[model samples]
Target: MKAMIKVTLKNGVLDPQGKAIMGSLQSLGFNGYDNVRQGKYFELDIEAFSKEEAKARATDMCEQLLANTVIENYEIEIV
Candidate 1:
């Protein structure tokens, strides 16, 4: 099974990196984008018997290490 975890800063948290990216995009003539946010994308391969198991394990991975729950939120996708 394959799982993906996307981690992003929670609302109200200052994202300097995202701001910088927005500035760079505007400067490069890539306008029409606003309030841009950046995040982490992780792809994991797991040996699971079902999609539920894969997602559950990936959720655990996010809770334990992939994401900092205090400042970040994560979503899981299983394939």
Candidate 2:
């Protein structure tokens, strides 16, 4: 199975990197982008007998290391 994980800063969290990217885009004449929140996307392959098992493992992976749950939120999709 393949899993796609997306981790992103929670709302109200300060994202300096996102701000910098937005600034760079503006400098290059790319306007109308007021806010940009950067996130991480991870693809993984795992051996699981069932979708439920895969989801559980993927959730554990996010809680353990893939995302900082205190300041970030994550979503996992298994395929």
Candidate 3:
């Protein structure tokens, strides 16, 4: 089974890196973009009997280490 995890900042959180990217984009003439949010992606190959199991395991991984629960949100996909 393959597990895909996406970690991103929660709403109302400050993102300096995203701000810097947006600034650079405008300077490079990539206009009309209002915001740029950054995130983390992880792909894992694991042994699981079903999609549910794979998603559960990936969720555990995110909560334990991959994501900062207090300030971040995570989504799990099994493929």
Best by lDDT: 2
Q: Which residue pairs collide, candidate 2? A: none
Reference-based lDDT, residue 10, model 1: 100
Instruction: Please say which candidate is ahead in lDDT: 1 or 3.
Output: 1
Candidate 3, residue 71: the lDDT equals: 98
Give the TM-scores of the predictions, in the order they appear.
0.95, 0.94, 0.95
Question: For model 2, how does the per-residue alpha-carbon lDDT over 1-79 read when each residue is reduced to its tens digit?
Answer: 9999999999999999999999899889997668899999999998999988999999999999999999999999999
Better of 2 and 3 by lDDT: 2
Which lDDT values do the candidates have, in the order given?
0.93, 0.95, 0.91
Error of 2 at 60 (Å): 0.4
Candidate 2 TM-score, C-alpha based = 0.94
lDDT of 1 by residue, 1-79 (tens): 7897899999999999999999999999997769989999999899999999889889999999999999999999998
Clash count for each candidate, listed in order shown: 0, 0, 0
How well does model 2 score by local distance difference test? 0.95
Each candidate: RMSD to true structure? 0.7, 0.8, 0.7
